[model samples]
Structures are given as structure tokens and as C-alpha cells.
Target: MKDTVMGTLSQRLEENQIQLNQLLGKSTDLVTKELQLDSSTHIALVYIDGLVDTQVLHNSILYSLQEGAIQDQFKDLDPFQKLELLRKRILIAGDLSVTHDFKQFVHQLMSGNVMVLVDGTADALRIGLPGWEDRNVSEPNSQSVVRGPMEGFTENMRTNTALIRRKIKDSQLWLETFQIGKVTQTSVSIMYLTHIASPDLVQEVKSRLGKIDTDSILESGYIEEFIQDKAATPFPTIYNSDRPDTIAAGILEGKVAILVDGTPFVLLVPTFFVSFFQSSEDYYQRSDISTLLRFIRFLSFFITLFAPSFYVAVTTYHQEMIPTSLVISLAAQRESVPFPAFVEALLMELTYEILREAGVRIPKNVGQAISIVGTLVIGQAAVSAGLISSAMVIIVSITAISSFVIPESGMAVAARIIRFALIGLAGFMGLYGILFGVFLIILHLASLRSFGMPYMSPIAPYRSSDLKDSIFRFPWPLLKTRPSNNKIQDLKRQDTSKREGSAYDREK
Candidate 1:
């Protein structure tokens, strides 16, 4: 615990703030250690530097002190009234503050505000100082869907929430705040629909969040693992996103969203396995186009999952299934490599992984000129250098690109990890091993549940109505009923019978 100071600056910093920073390993530069006192006013302007808007802060705090607004507000009213009115109207653009105590004042300043104090004043008035000190919103590099809203979430939590809020525009949308980490004390918000969302699910999510015991929460992934239901599965239970429309859609569908400060990724719980294939673009466009795109995504998904394994199986055990020409070409390509086909594939994969890591680790911001876009040349060079076979390079490149095509990056990573397992299985017993491995993966997915709803819903539980929206989307008019499992109250999507009858009469 930080030592609580009664009424002194030197005393407070020496006891509370320094100890707290040391405990937390916080940046000393962010902590504003300042002291100023006039004849009737002594003040401590403790704030996180760079986060405050200097112009607004100087206008509010220093200008108020010079103008004597603090003393003037206190002249007619009681001590409490002065603090309240000044903070309500004169200082804060709104009434976000409930108290004018030292602790509350400091907290507000840390969150971006200017604090004003007088020597004789009992409490401090926090001036509204919202700073625009963050990177501009940019296109999401990870979950880039071609036909959806181009806006993406940023590291700033408030900006991220605002982007989603713009999409929702409903009063029933609720945001509950909490601080998770002991030292970091990072801000986290849980967003959900109050009326439409399941009460049990909301409470369950809150219960899990409250149970977390951690010193710092730096990313949504940290909260994801802590709150997730355990069954020793490698696949992620939480759906992580960098798009606000996707999160807003999730909130509308009765899922709880967790947004942590300082990371673009947000976590949505009770996410179905089908959601990994679904994109924000799926809902924004015409139903026919949506259906076609959805089907293509599904094909890409299965291709990513089974392509390498199928290739291995056909080359090794199921050689009869391959065309004679392909076999001759692949055989000719592999003849130079002393290693087996499987070994060659493994070597290429490892080499690609190293190059991918190198690309990320070499920070472009720090003047590193290395670009991964020349990957084709690198692969060609590798083959020419006799480090890998041409067939292996092609296979590795295709697999990597296929994995990228999966909309949900978490699932893409899951596919990558599972692909390796499938490769191992294929190398062992070819077709049989590959089948056994895929079967296990399917079984695991079927058994997994998100907030008591099976991960593979509509397929595992078999709901025909929900299937219209899942796997492959059907025509919007044909989807006359809401997804049954979603349990939406406004279920009648369209009057399909009336439309069909009118169309028949017109034709006649």
C-alpha cells in the first residue's frame, strides 16, 4: 500500500508516490513531481506528464489561480459548493467527478485532467483536460476485410470504446469499469447490452473478471486466459479483435467485450467457432455476396487446415491418387535433396518461421530497412543455394498465405499450430494418420463450449435456422427468422410468406 499523506507535498511524495512507483516499476518521467505555493494558496500539481493537454491545463489551472476563480467560487458558497461548481461548470467540461478529495483529484489527473488547489482550500478542483495524445486510427493490419468499415481500434482505450459506441448508438449498451492489475492498475471496461444480453452470462463474465489475481494486465490476451474455461485445449476460447464493428456486432449478439488500456486487441467471450470464419463484411453487404464470400472463407479455412497434410499423404502413401506428371515433377525436384519429403517440408517451415520473426523484431520505427515483401526472392535464393527444395518452398509459401486468409488472426494462429501437428501425423502414417489427427481436432472443437454454448454450434447441436447465418450465409429474405441460439427478442426478421405470395401473384 502507498503511504497516505495528510496535507503535505514533500511528505506525500516521500511516503506514497515514490514507494508506489518503485513497487510498480513505472516510468519516473510520467510522474509529475511539482510544488507551488502563493500567499493564500499551496498546491501540488501531480500528474502523468505528456498525457495532459498543456494548453488546456495551463488555461484551467494556472489561469484560474491567476484569475482567483478558486477563491471567488468559495466566497459565497461553502467549501464543498466551491469545489463542486468549479469542477462541474468552470473546470471540467462535464460532471465526471463525484468527489474533490486528494485521491480522486490525483486519479483524475492521471486519467488526463488539471488539478487546482489553494493553501486554505479543503479540497482540489480538477479541470477537464482531455489530451489528444495518441496515434491516429489506421486500418487493422491483422483482420483486414475488404468490404467492411475501414476504421480500426487504437491503443487508447477511450478512443477504442468511442469507435464501438458510434456503431452501437443505444442506451441499453452498458460499460462497466474496473482496474485489474495490482501494480499496473490498468483500466479495463466490460461492454454489454443490459436488456438483450443474458443475465447469467453477464454475471458469469463479471465473476470471472473479479476472480483474476494478477499484478499487471498489459493485453486482452492476459484477461482472456484468466477468464477462459479450462480443458487443456490449444485453441483460444476468447475471440480477439482490432475492429470496432466486429466488437459492436458481438455486443449486440449478447457477448461480453473486454477492452484493456494500451493494446489494440479486445476480447469477446462466449464466441462460437463459426465466428472465426465470420467477418464484419458478412453483414454489411448484400446477402448473396455475403454468402459467396462466407463460402470462400470456409474453403480457404479448410484448405489452410488440410492442404499440407493432403499433399504429404498423396506424395507418400496415396501416390496413386496424384497425376503421373505431378509425381514426376515433384520427384525430380526432390531428387537433389538427400532428406525425405517430410524433412524437407519441416526445414522450409522452420526457415520461414525464422524469417517471419526477424521481420517483426526488426523495428521499422528504429530505422531498420529490412522488408519481408522480398520473401519470394529469399525463397528463390534459398532453393538456388541448395538449402531447400523448390517443391518445399512452394508448399511453405502457399501454407503461410492460406493461413493469412483466415479472418480471425487467433484462429489463423491456431491453424498454423494445428497444421504442424497434421504434418507430423501425415509424415508418420500418411492418409490414416492425417485422418486420425483431423478427427481429433473436430472432436475437440465439438466438445468445447463458450459460456455453455458449444463452440461448433448449429453443426454439433444442429439448428437449421442458425445454419442460414453460419457456415454459409443464405439470402437475407430467406433468413426470415433470427438465429435461434442467439435468442434475440426481435426474432421476426422478415415476412417471407407475404413476400413469396405477392411475388407469385405478380408473376401470374
Candidate 2:
């Protein structure tokens, strides 16, 4: 079959019977496929709402056709050479691209590339002019901070890739594209520094991606679970972020990043235990402030994971763990509540989770109002009604607030779920339960390997040099070497030891 250009996709779609419509995902973005077949012929066009540049398609192909389009002379060119020539000389007709595979052609079309099909042609002409309106780069909503690069990943993959390219201008930086998802045909980009990345890890990731047998992949989360090292683990084996700077940093550190179309968040593989405790701001701020913040985040993470368990163990089985005055206060508070410690904690946790879930699912403008009202109504109203003690309210509130301190929201969420199991254990065996839970968690973390690198990384292997970047912020100059745990062969990042935390801080 031959590829043809038409003024209108409707021209190829005889009878003007081309069909188009949006997709069924919960997201409001537009996606559609149009099929124009009459009696015996068949052709289709697909495009994502904002992703396809229809004007470009019209101007390039339609204008060329109306003006008696001239086809490039690639008579001696092979298919590959012909494709390249079309891209270079012919289809420079604006943003039009040409493709061969029917499935891939449809995929491109859905992604906002216009498709042109002529009668009796086996191949389709796929045009590239993605014009999807994306939000301008801004600070990540979940990872907002006063310091750090304000640029965030946009939903558009091209824009997201550009952001990283701007950060690391090395020619070794590589971006490999693959169309994942059997039906959804989502575009995923695997990026890494060619010289620094481990070949084994790259192969492993590619193999895992090739094995993903899913009909749809809406976001990086879908790709994460499908390619996760383990199926049933509370810990997140893959790291994800909405910040371009974060992904760029990961890439520089010999880590690989996965960028999926249709989502702003990208995936970082072989993430170490220390990464979850880190914030993008840590690298942007003064080392003293960064270290302090890191310490606080670590402390807050423990509070999120152990606070309720600590409370339950002390109040229920180990009253001796509580001070005498505190014990009396707890007793007084519980006297008015009709539930046992386990029941009370469970009820409050479930309530908080429900409130949080509802808050997020609600409309954007109303989400904050719902959260405020829900918290006030649940905590204050329950306290006034003597249904829950004010002390328990405070404990739950503290736990929720602490959870937010974790820079990685996905890991924080996993920790929150596991906290309940820890609480149950604590209620049964007092401090022993907490210790047992922590022991298991630590063991699991130590045993876990992400693309052959230990999940605990510098801690598990115990590299003193790499420790400079873990759990504490060392001066940028001091971190002259890459983390040995990343398994990057050329591990030296820089040799300049003449550096303080910041120029401003030093001047002060």
C-alpha cells in the first residue's frame, strides 16, 4: 500500500463518515479514534485532544496537496532511507510524519499525530504535530518548597524530556522511546547517561518492560508495579517524582529514569533507602539547613511509622512506659471513650484515611475546604460528643502531619499502611511488637535488590564516602564522587574539594 497526503483526513475518509470522540479515563484529557469504512474499504484516524496539532496537519498536508504537492525523489532509497528522506525533505510539510505499521500508525494518531490513508495503500502516513495544551512548568504540588528549581515535569513527555536535557547537557544523556501497553499504547521513555549506566541494569529494565502485559498504563505507577522487583512488598522498589530536577539528579547519579506520556510524574529505578528521606530542596539550600531538614524528615518518618504503636503499647500493655502523670491523663481521657485502644486507633485511622481520600477525590477548589471541615467536624465534634478523646485526636493528627514530612509520597503511604500492622503488634506484645516489626522491615530492606544494587545501598554495603550524601547533606564540593552504590564505573563526579555548603552561607 502507498502513503498519501490529503487536504483533510476526511478526504481519505470517503463519505465524510469519519468518527471521533474522547476516551473513558477518569482524566479530563481528550483522546479519540475515527474509522471511515464504506462497504469494502477501511481506514481510521486517531488523535489525542491536545496532543495533535490539527492546524499543522492541515497546513502541511492540505496546503501541499492544494498546491500540487511535490514528492521527494527517493526512488533508490530503501524503506528506512525513504522514511528518513521523508522526515528530512518531503514531510517537512509542516509537522507531518509518515509511518508503516497499522497498529503503530493508530497509536501515533491517538497521541495527536494525524493519520492519512489512501485507497489500496498498505501503509499509513502518520503526521507529527502534537499540540496538546499542557500546564506551564511549576513547582510540584506535593513537593512544594521555598527553595530549589521551580521547574516541574509537565504532562507532555517532550516538555518533560527538554527539562532534563536543559539540566544535563552531556552528549552521553540518552532517551530511548518505547510504546508500552498493548491497547493504550502509551509512550514511555527510558533515559540514562550511556557511559555511566550499568548495562545489566538497562537490560533488566528493558526485559521487564517488554514483559508488561497490560491493556492500559495511565501513569508511572502502572509501570512501577508491573516492573517492580517484588509483587507483595510494602516498600516501593521504584522511585517516582513530579520534579524534573529530581529525575535529572537521579540520572546524573547513574540511575535510570522512566518518562511516560499522559502523566507528569516520572519513575526512577534502583532507588536506595536513603532517597526516600531526601527532598529536592536539600540540594538547593544551605548544607546546614539541608542537614537539619533531612534530620527532621527522618524523625518525622519514624513518628509516622511508630507513633501510634508507641502510644498503644504504652497505654494498653505497657503503662509503665508512660510517665505516672501521663498514665493518669491517659486513663482520664479513656474513661469517657467506650472503645478499647485497638478499636479506638483503628476507628480513628480509618476515619482519617477516609477524610484524606475524600479530600483528594473531591474537586480541586473544594478539596481544601472539605479537608478543613472534615477534620474539624470529626475531631472537634467527636470530642464534644465524648465519642473520642481529645488526646487520641492529637495523636492521630500528629501521625498524619508526620506522614507529610516524607518527601516520597508513595513510600509514605506504604509506611502509613504498615503502621497499623505495627500498632496491632504493639498492642499485643508491647515494645516487643514494635521491635519485631522494625526488625522485619529492616531485614526486608536489606535483602531487597533494585537492579542488582542493594536497596539500603551505601548503608548496606557501608561505603563511608557515599554516606556523605545519605541522611545528611554534605557540601556540594564534598560530594565530588558519585555514590559507589549506584554501580557507575566512572564513579568520580568531581575532584574540587574547595567548596563550602553555599557561597552566600560562606560570605555570611
Candidate 3:
């Protein structure tokens, strides 16, 4: 007992119990029950209180061992033989493993597994009895859809994986598990299609995950930030979703998904910039309608990013670009405002952002009402008080509304941050500065990579094959091949012989 916890088990049972208590600090929840097999052998059960199922412990392990018939069978065997018999015949649990390492024993015990140690054996049996509380599967709040699966991922990793497994039942679907975080020992899992995903990309993902040596990983964001390609850029290289169908779709597209234990959001790797604009409902609805909606989203992205900056530039520098009547109206509106165009735009944008954040942070019952009424009242008051022009208010409102059109919040936030920088540049150098900013932004996007895949794939490098599903999605019948930009091993998604001719051609 004095040497180390890793030492071989002593023939005396009391010494083992004493060493376990010393290592565990004799916590109140650490239950250790001692039992005797006739007059020769002894055994102990060690487990945490709330983590284990008491009903199973009583009816499965304790009741079976306390029976006279079971004790009679144990009396004829040695300690090692008795332990083997207990594991093979006695335990009613589905999963059980034998471990000799002291560190692994403690780890299993803390993870809600019951440990059974014999009087004279070095190895111990770990019984699975996890009974922790968790939320039930429900609809996703962030990425809701009009026509698709309503079921979303819960905090449980097994449940999340099962959700995906239920959707895609292919034999080639592979799942690999890892234990990260030295202190928390969080369970992480990566899943991909064996036939579709690149083996090199899988190896690179495993290599990066192995390099993480932090003390804790509370959320998937921690892993995302640690393993992403560019840490300096505002653009997100990794895509995250709480919908199982979305994750399953990514797997089918030759992408890998990382599922963390304690969070519902799963991270998808090798994501392209176009993915943020796509939604789960896109594939469910008609391709023509989905394509039109996608085009609107793309238009809204630019409007959200450049609306205020364009206004500032046109008013302060390029007045000739505006029509005579519209210019007269804009000039008349701003005549009452004391501040310059840039200052007025900045002030309105900041105020709207504050109100949006306040609405989110407040209680849900009154939050929406307050945000709506607050915006209307504040806008009217500012215009009447001559604090900001009515035209500037309208511009900020349109810009704010356009931001909600983007499917992903991360990309929308990047647009919000870049908008201010564009506004500043426009204030000094006008339209030329705005053009320069757009060039630099595109340059940065072209330079970024996610797990060796181009961030602006099928656009910057210009892949004609991938354009079928880029800005506008083609019909499902026409999309017979996978994206070539991902460099996947499999190129053909379906057989072209199954494809039929269009209705017009058939009629002719």
C-alpha cells in the first residue's frame, strides 16, 4: 500500500480497501462494500453513489452474490477463477472490461462504472452502469426548417451517433472514438463514410485531435478553435450543426463529423464557404425553389455586408452616381442631422446591435416584445429628435434584416465585423477604399483552407463540375456526381442510366 497504487493486489483484503480509500480521499459518495466467500476469499465493490443504478446493482450484482447457491459455487474455485466466473456468468450488464492499470481503474470508477476487485487478483472488472440525466431529443432551435426531420441531437454522444446511424445504415459508415482532456477525460468521436471520405483527410483529422493537450474541453467550440486551419481569420473554417440529417448529409458528401460528449452541436470538417448558405430544407424542397431562395440569400449576404458602406461612400464621395431626385431627397433628410454621414451610420448600427443583443439576453417571454417595440420607439424618437437621419435608419434596418437571411450565425457575425471596417475605409477614401476592402476580403478567403480543402472552393479556383450545387443548386436528377473539389475517392454518386429525360423531351 505504501509503494504505489499500481502495485499488485495484496492477499489481505483490508489493505486494498485502505489504499483505495487513501487514493479517493474517503469521499462520502465513494461506496465500498466488503463481502466474504466462505472463510478464505474476500471481495469489494467500489462505485459512486448517483452515477450508478441502484436497482441494477441490487438485483444483478449484490443479489446474485449474496445467494447461498452462488456462494457455494465460488467456494470451490481460487480467487482468479472466481473473478473470471463472476465476469462471465454473474454480471448482467451489457459491457464489461478487465483492467490492471490503477489509473484506468480510477478513471472507470469516476465514469459511472462499478469496479469489482478480488482478494488476490491484480486485475479488476469494470461494469457499465451509466445512469446520468440528459435531455430528450427535440427539434433544433437554431436551424429549424419548414420541411425536414424535426429530431435534433441531445447532449449524449451515444444518442447523437445513434441518430446519425438511424439515418444512414450503410456498412461503410465508420466511427472512431478518442479520449481527450487530461483532467475531464471527455469522449470525442469522429464519423465518416469509409468509401467516400479521403483516407489522408481522416489521418490528418486524427493527427490534429491527438495534438490537443488541454485540461478540459467543455464544448465543441474549444476543439474547433484548436484544430481549425486559420486562427487569425474571422471566417469560420469549421461548420457546426445540431441536426442529425445535416450531419448525415455531410457524411454522404465525403465530409467528417466530430461529436463531443457534453454538447449538442457537432462539428463538420473540410467545410466550404458555400455550405454556410445551404440549409437542411434545400434538398427536401423542389430544386427550382431552393435555387431561387439560395440566390436571395447570396444577395442578402452582400446587402448585409456593403449596404451601409455603399451609402456612406455614395453620399460622401460619389454624389454623381445618385439620381437627381433621390440625391435631393437624401440631402434634404440629412440637412437636419448635425453629424457626418459616417458617424450617423455608425451610431444607428451600434444602437441596433445593442438592442438585438439585449433581446437575446433577456427573458424569452418578454424579449421579443421588447425588441420590437424598442426598435420602433427608438427609431421614431431618434428621427424626431434630429439625432440621426430617417434614410440612415432605413439603411440600418434593411442591413439588420438582411443579416438574418444567412443560414449560419458564424458567417453572419463575420459579415457584421467586416461591415464596420468597410464603413471606416469609406469614411476616409470613399468608393476606392470600398473596392480595395472587397479585394482584400476575397484574397483572404482564397488563401484560407479547411483541412487542406479550399475555403472558396468551386468559386475562386473555378471548378465547373462543382458549380451544379454552388450558388444555385441543380435538380437532383442532374446532380449525379459528387463534388470534385473535395478530392474524394469516389466521384460517381449514382448511375446515369437511372436518369430519365426531361418532360419536354418525353412529350416531343
> Model 3 off-target regions past 4 Å?
1-15, 365-373, 500-508
- Name the 10 consecutive residues with the lowest summed lDDT in model 2: 1-10
- Each prediction's TM-score against the native? 0.83, 0.82, 0.95
Clash totals for all candidate models: 2, 11, 0
Q: Give the TM-score of candidate 1.
A: 0.83
Off by over 4 Å in 1: 3-45, 68-85, 88-106, 117-124, 323-326, 362-389, 487-508
Q: Clashes in model 3: which pairs?
A: none
Per-residue lDDT of 250-336 in model 3, one digit per residue for the tens?
999899999999999999998999999999899999899999999999999999999999999999999999999999999998888
Worst 10-residue stretch by lDDT in candidate 3?
1-10
lDDT digits (tens) for residues 271-386 of candidate 1: 78888888888887887788787777777777777777777777878888878998898888766667776776666666666666676687656312222344556767877877
The whole-model C-alpha lDDT of candidate 3 against the native structure comes to 0.88
Scored by Cα lDDT, where does model 1 land? 0.71
Better of 1 and 2 by lDDT: 2
Arrange candidates by lDDT, descending: 3, 2, 1
Off by over 4 Å in 2: 1-51, 68-91, 95-107, 115-125, 365-373, 497-508
lDDT by residue (1-508, candidate 2, tens digit) is: 1122222223334332232221223444443344322233343444556776777756664554334233334345443454454456656654655555544554565666766554334445666676767788887887777887877888889899999999999999999999887677888989999899887878888998999887888888899888887777888878888888889999988889999988899999889888998988888888988999999988998999998888888788888767899889888877888887777888888888888889899897888566545765788788888787888788888888888789888789888889999989987888899999999998888888776788887888788988888987887766778888877767888754444566634543
